[model samples]
Target: MNITWNKRQLELRERFREVATDLVAVGSDARDRDASFDRELWKELAAADFWRLQVPTGAGGLGKDGWDWLAAMEGLSLGARDLGFLMSVASHSGLIRLLLTAGTPEQQHRWLPGLTSGEVAATGSTEESGGSDIRGLSTRAVPTADGGFVLNGAKAHITNAPVADVVMLAARTDTEPGAFELSLFVTRTDVDGVGSGPGEDLLGLRTSPTGPIAFRDVRVDADAVIGGVGEGLTRLYNTLAYDRILFGIIVGSSLEAQLEPLVRQLETRHAFGAPLSAQQYMQEKVVSLTMAVEGSRALAYRSFGQLEDQHDGYSLSASVTKLFASTGLVGSGLDLVQAFGHSGYESGSAVERNLRDSVAFKIAAGTDEMQKKNIFNHVRRAYRSGELAPGSRGSGT
Candidate 1:
């Protein structure tokens, strides 16, 4: 795939880089230590129109494509150096896309402005019982006499829950146990019976506040349903298709950022009267990391192309991209720590923070094991259906 950025896209990416460097760099250590989200930085992002890049022009957004959005995200990740803040932005972007894709006209009209203008949003799909398993969700949404629904359940580890203005809540609306029985609702967080749990102090991404959200008989009219009743799974999977690709970019870019500074340090720092970069072992490690970053970029952009083209294998491609990129990121982070040695391990060091942050990529979109399982299932199904050549099953796709 030819992944070329035009003049306009390049310009936008540079602009994002500058803004992120200026706004997100300050007090990063303090914010991470305090486990606080930077509301002021968020305002700066809003003023720069970072939040509306993916929203369509008709809905008062910038009408940029997926590639442009990914580029901007990469720029921000490169400059920000704060994984928590990037997580918040990525979550907000995902919710905006979901709204644009499935929200009714009135629903979009009501929420798109605020959402695109930097008002935070959260997704409440994972319950305490199940992390990413939609089948294990127990949240219930029973229809009321007034044609609305009364939602009752809890969502755990919800990003931006404490400050979100709106939440995309998924709950079981039917008795039968299956993916299709679920429905997606745009629930206002301020409504009665909706409560947020205390913020969690996480190992990484500490600047992004995450907590549980409770829904005790939360009521919403039928108009709150996104897409349609029993279509939550479909909409969710659709959103994941894009989200996984963006995540690949996020991890890849962050790794690239970490790799660059380490490389510079290795080139300048001397050990045994020789630059660290002159060491054969260190050179090999840096070369491997550089290759990984490039490979991840290729996979991410290729997956983006597949999605844009609506390829039959886009889902499989996206999963592979996420798997490859996230694993590469974690590996590269380890390489950075090794290259920097004791200095890298020091408290408040960028390399140390990156090592802590890179780990979350493996668990965020889906775990490494989960991605492998998805790849295996998809390939197995294809092979059984005679899609694979006689001896091509073990060969790389």
Candidate 2:
């Protein structure tokens, strides 16, 4: 239950905050209006080694651990109000972790350097059928005689797909669709038959360009297979498990950023012949939001600690953290908007933008319903196995 950060973690947080401040200073609302991802800003982040934070030193990364990674992400989110930019960075980190964990040595050597250097990488698992249902994906990858594969499918709502250099694509290698039939391939976007659709007009995170990618007879060698044939589900699940926890911290940090502006407004803006902060209702709202932010941070840190400890229930813990933190973010965003009154509802306002950004968190990684289902299934299995005492009503191991 120790909640203290060491010197290194504190120093890293400060460094990330400084980088975020510099980036924010150069950022303009034009990026959001244009729905563009700033290549120059991404390069700045890369030069700062933000992309290398999760990578291993031997692989040309910063060699930081999970806690450090969370700290960096949280700090970056707190300093940079651009949720879309942060989302893009987080997605690249997830792809890197997948490659490092499941990729072959040759594959890692070929792709890790570029990915860690902030050359964008994307994951194409979500299809038009629905991202939540993996078993329903229709993307097919037929094996060729030349020890390669011809992929034909389209991925929807792919983050950073518009400008990604490499994509970790999921497709069905078997005739029948099921969990075991899926496989992952690292497909180069520059190859023939790889097409990207126009940028999507999303409600939020507009700066992080998103679009659909079509793979029409896209060819890749057998060496492109990640982990192995029929291992896509396993690899994907692992990636999401890690991503859910990390995203919790990101959302928590974003919530923290919203608090300061809110407090400033309350302290400076007079209402009913006094400052808003003097009102009991305003004070209550601030206290509630403060508690939510702190709770989210605690949950994220605890789940990460469980992961580092390799606890048996870490998967469930991650799901819980993601579910709570994302929903909490959405709630807190709404509260902040209400606290800001009319100014918050103005176009391009920070609170309005944050609300839009926070809503996406519920859908990304896994939806709120999906997390509930996962938690339910885990609890059911534990209870049925007598891991939980019949009347104890406790979360079983």
Please list the residue runs of candidate 2 whose C-alpha ends up more than 4 Å from where it truly belongs after superposition. 1-3, 175-180, 308-310, 390-397
Structure candidate 2, residue pairs in collision = none
Q: Write the per-residue lDDT of candidate 2 for residues 1-397, one digit (tens) a residue.
A: 5556778888888888888978842564677767888887887888888777767777777788767767777778778878788778777777787877787778777888887665888888898889999988888888999999999999999999999998988888886533348888887899999999987899998988888999998889999889898888877887787778877777777777778888998999997899999999888878877776787778778777776666777788889988988878888888888989988898888788888878888998889999999999998988898777767665423
In angstroms, the error of model 2 at 93 is 1.1
- Highest TM-score scorer: 1
Top lDDT model: 2
Query: C-alpha displacement of 346 in model 2, angstroms?
Result: 0.8
**All candidates' lDDT scores?**
0.81, 0.82
lDDT of each residue in 1-397, candidate 1, tens digit only: 5677788778877888888788897788899888898777787798788877877787787888767777787788778878888888877877777877678767777888888666888887777887767778889899988999999999999889988888988888886644348888887899999999999878888888899999998889989888898898877776676777877777766677767687798899999999999999899878877777777778778877877777767788888888887778778788888888999898788878877877887887667777888899988999888779676554332
lDDT of 2: 0.82
TM-score of each: 0.94, 0.93
Candidate 1: misplaced stretches above 4 Å? 177-180, 390-397
